[model samples]
Target chain A: MFDTSTFIRLLPELILLVTALVVIFVDLYARRRTALGLLPGLSIVGLALSFLAVFAQWGTREVVAQTLAADTFAAFFKMVAAVAVILVVLASVRYMRARTRYVGEFYAFLLVATLAVYIAVSARDLITLYLGLETLSIVSYVLTGFLRDDKRSNEAAIKYFLYGAVASAIMLYGFSLLYGVTGTTDLQEIARRLLNGDVLVNMEWLAWPAIVLVTVGFAFKASLVPFHQWAPDAYEGAPTPVTMFLSTVSKATGFAVMARMFLVAMPALQSSWTALLYGLAVLTMTLGNLIALRQTSVKRMLAYSSIAHAGFILMGLVAVTTALGQPFNGLDGVLMYVVAYAFTNAGAFAVVAAVEDGTGGATLDHFAGLVGRAPFLAAAMLIFLLSLAGVPPLAGFAAKLFVFAPVVRQEYYVLAVVALINAVLAAGYYLKVVKQMFFVEEPERAPFAVARSMRWALWLMIIAVFGVGIFMNWFAFMASQGAAGMLGL
Target chain B: MVPLSWYLTVAALLFVLGLYGVLSRRNAVAILMGVELMLNAVNINLIAFWRYTRPDNVAGLVFAIIVLTVAAAEAAVGLALFIALYRLRETVNVDEIDLLKG
Candidate 1:
């Protein structure tokens, strides 16, 4: 018999949903000016408590009626999403209050979006995954246009909505094709059927197309090269907190879905998809870095850099397929990279937001000699840029090393070399930001005040970035364990 | 009874038409309509698959419902964005909204 315990297993998401609704309700009764200040703090506490609840359930695996699978991987991503929510709330307390209206709604949406990401990473069946992705995407669409008074924000929101809708539809169509071919929406069941060899081999042509469509859908979410057209403008146009949310938590969730689907369910079809991932890995990394070099807007540069990092994560996927003749072990690289990326990218965006607060703009020129004006922000930005460039003694370098280690172990020398070259190219642009900040003359009349909450957020993010790198082995172990559980090994 | 291929082919054609509309149309609202058309094509394929392949299981039916709900949410947010853009720039043309272009 179906039981109430099943519903209890989803307590964290329930809490978030309740909090979001309560925030909406409470905002109506409170003074408008103070509500903006009070709501984000309340949401942060709720998110932190939800994270604790999810943490308590770590290592407890359950298949919720063949739809959602509450597992360690879900717990790991939930923790990450919770961290993202906390940082977003902290960053937005100052950023949103000064620039945008409807602050309570904004914080509520962020929490709801985090809940969606949690569900997305945990979804065992196709339907649940689709629902989760759509939820995340919809909230993001609204958040991107939260600054409705800003023309760029409005434009960004429209473009994001149109492109995201198309991608979701394509993804759904692909899911339908898979369902048609396999007659099952449960990933595990589909994997078992495919491994049986008779149905799959007999319908190889149909199977290939179905796989292609499914991949295309996931690829759009991951923002792989060909499907990444929406990222830059959207990241630039959205308020800075939303940009950080999209770049870190949203991208990480996309990879989680990709890892779950391809590594677990579609391992039988590695022969077909592995080569495709390799091509995408090379293209995404190269294109993202090359284009980022020319961007004058700091936000857009990070946007492209995030796309490049997506490519780096794809390399780990490629390693999973080609190296060790298995996909499971390759996930360690992906997990570590994501953890490292979450901290460094969030820290970088925090610095950008701080700079934006000071100068009231995000252009590259605005950051000239930022070190002279705001030494702490400059130092934080330097650390983030260096970490992003994969410099030694930083989390980004450790992430790259983890990703490349398996490739070397498996002797995929050429792929590792390509990744190395991309890393070097990435450093060129990241260093450009650093050089402009520290070595150039201070731009006249740079606004240099950072809100206390934003400053704390930046410090925390920087400390996390450096701490993870310094304790690389421990971080790697946690990442590897999470990956191992996701692969069910 | 209509063959499954007939339904699939029509769905594919509708998807292509939607893609064409999204790519060629300058108006944001038209692009949204195109997106809706594409989602409808997907819904058709899902229901057809459920009817033909997984008749015993209702997962596909459940997924179709979820997709429809999501599509509605997407349209709401999208139209809101269009309204916002219309108010800000007094136009919904995609080409005219390229302020951040390099």
Candidate 2:
């Protein structure tokens, strides 16, 4: 049953897994040899190869009988995940080497984490989706605690684990309920059954609870409000590079799976879930922004800010239906917003990682007169913060435009107003960081040398931020193809 | 032959009880136990649904087994994290694990 054609389809995953194993073994020996750089070099080669593998599999909807999705929707996220992971590996080279001894395992786990994202975005079956999410979750747990000697790292891992375990279990129960009602694990089959009405004769009431429960699970993963208790702590305590991965790649997995499940399996019950997300969007945006206002720790501030961004992304999902042109469906806005935000937030976190490296912490005190100490780092951070605040000529601007346009067009006037207000409130804190860097009274501190790899990662993020924004046409087209693949059903 | 609701009822009770333990427990290990119970409840529900509804298909059975296996993995990882925490701070009581805060 396992044919060569299936092998061709799964080429990217195969290459990543093989790279992970090779890194682990080579690192085991490299440790005794003190050859610190080989694993990252090998990992990047694997990532570059998978980039080609994913490209090879493009426009694959015509492919028959594959377990995972071959559509542009999944393909788009695979691209995003690859970009994020590559940036993270580039940046973490020196930082991680300074902190831990298991450098090879770190690189290996990072590769496996990327494979998890590939599985998740491509999942068409409930069981496969569960596997993808759990794989990412477990990998994240290990990565968060990788600094075994640090008490804070241990605390963060336990908090993340406790929250993650219960959430996934609840989500599993939700999946079981859906399975009981539909009697099929395939998402399309479940949709067909749900829409048939006869299949739901008396079990119709179960659908609502199932949706609510399933959402609880994904919401926790996505770190939406009320279920977001662990995010700030975990982000604040985990090593900064892992924090970057968590906020960008891992969070994207949550939205990818959420969008697929709702848009594909449960569009028949659109009104119910949309309404649910609407309330979550408001609460998440307002609370995430408000609390971010108080965090002195820059890392915790970014954590809450990421949660706020999740709310902004949810608005795109809420306003799913639109007369906006092809691929301009609410989901495409979510996709474009995500693609843009990935670069911007990553750049922001990369700067934070650098500052932490120099100052031994990431608080306002560390940032004071940053321009005098590290003019280039401060300037790059300023651009990232501006982009995040939706200033024009940056990726965050394009992201906000794509998402907000849909909500305005849908005439969700209240949600639009709330989101707009939150945007302003969010700007207040972003500028606070800017103010610390530029307006402080501290004397010039000596500049610290950022590793070459870290500099390269920052440059890539900054360019992508500008590139995605100014060249919005190309990314919009890619996102349009992705959304079309999903809803063309 | 037992009715389906009997299994579902037992599962729901177990789930709620586990949730209670998770909410109220201070010891990290006890909380892990609570999470294990919740996962077990999910397993029971999956098996009962499979047994009663579609005995012909293996989807339900397969899902239950996957959950069982993953749950063990989750517990193992959780325990490892707890042990690391215990060694660092000399206590695994979550209430005392307060180094990271607002």
Candidate 3:
């Protein structure tokens, strides 16, 4: 009875696995000079194909024998992950060649990481989730230090590894506690047992520890305040393309897992967890922005800014819990914010990479008079910065508004007001970058040229930022629909 | 049979020791060892829980195995990074690498 049905259901993962192994072989055999060039192309094609396969499974809901779930929520995230990989690959082609030596492994690891994200989103059981998250974390550790000769890269990789390992361990411990209490690892079965109060009444003392440990694990991945010390150093030290991938894809996957676990499986404990999330949201936003203001290095600044944005997303999660006893329409804001962030953050990093390629600069001062030299690059940066600051007529504004509207509806006036204040504080740093780009005089060096590939990615991201910003309603609808599907609404 | 509290207390001690290693050690390799110890503590917890609460469920066992596999992979990559760092900087002192420091 347990034939190839599981493999069939996981067709996308199967294809990706085969492709990753094949890519390794190809990298080993291909000519050294051409390997880097061909490998990214191969990765892009594989990711595209996997995306199509995931789409083919859309609207289908089935438990793949208790380990994985084929559902619309998974399909939606699969599409997002695929798109993120495509963009990262596109942006990486030039950056990797210029900076990194082992391009083959870099591309291969990225593909594997994307596959891990797919698995994480599709996981139906705690074991599968752990396996998937570990896969992603391991590959990312390798990729973070891909520049073997760079000191910064080495340090970043170590810190990331140490933190990630500890977090995973804590998470596993929590999973064990839950298994002890519920006698099941499948999310649905655990939920059923908990709702029936069979486990809750019997093992009430274990619940708080389990919740705290699991929250710590998820918080590390999401880069919440106390656990976020590694993010800035890691982001600044890793290669730019890797930073983009970490901020967007890695962070989004954390949210996906959190939504799946807390919203679906542990809805019974909303009151306890919501308080924790609220504290994290406030601390993450305030600390992230306040520290970012003093940074001179653009990469480090963005790293802190990304942390602040994580806080914003956490606010949406808080809204989802506060508005109702369950995560429902409130999740729409988080989803929309994520989509907007994916575009804007990726675009910002792409522009940073482009500038770095040209001027060998990664500091804010290096961008002085950038507007006079590279108008398009400066313009792209402006759009991304504005969107990030939550300015009107930009995707960021819409996202913030969408999240706050629900909080208002739920009459959480204080939370909404705090979020608004944080948004204003965030503007201070975003504008500093903009001012440096346009107001200062260009240094007396020849202007750097943006690569064709980089230009194409930037243009696409700009269009996405604006398109999502202007048609806010459409995105809100899609996000709400997706959230409903996740909740089985 | 070991009491569940004993297992939990041992796991907790291991985790705290690991945490101390991670925060106090300056050498990257020592820090990695700390991380490994923590991971082992977690594995013990998983097995203990499986035996005590869900004797009928195999998922905890499966998860512990998976966690071991991932820890090994992580160690390989982490050591590679250390090797790379040692080559570049000629030292492994965490405090010395301050290029990206705030």
- lDDT by residue for model 2 over A200-307, one digit each (tens)? 346668888899999999899889998999999999889899999999999988999999999889978999999999999999999999999999988899999999
- How accurately is candidate 3 docked according to DockQ? 0.69
For each candidate in turn, the interface RMSD (Å) is: 1.4, 1.0, 1.7
lDDT of each residue in A382-411, candidate 1, tens digit only: 999999988878889888888888777667
lDDT (C-alpha, whole model) for all candidates: 0.85, 0.89, 0.84
Span of 10 residues, lowest total lDDT, candidate 1 chain A: A321-330
**Which candidate wins on lDDT?**
2
For model 2, the local distance difference test gives: 0.89
Q: Judged by DockQ cut-offs, is candidate 3 incorrect, acceptable, medium or high?
A: medium
Question: Which 10 residues in a row give candidate 2 chain A its minimum summed lDDT?
Answer: A321-330
> DockQ winner among the candidates?
2
Candidate 1 whole-model C-alpha lDDT, 0 to 1: 0.85
Candidate 3 residue spans exceeding 4 A from truth:
A1-8, A200-202, A321-328
B-chain TM-scores per prediction = 0.97, 0.97, 0.97
DockQ of each: 0.77, 0.81, 0.69
Q: TM-scores of the models, in the given order?
A: 0.96, 0.98, 0.95
Q: Better model by DockQ, 1 or 3? A: 1
How far residue A447's Cα lies from its native spot in candidate 1, in Å, is 5.8
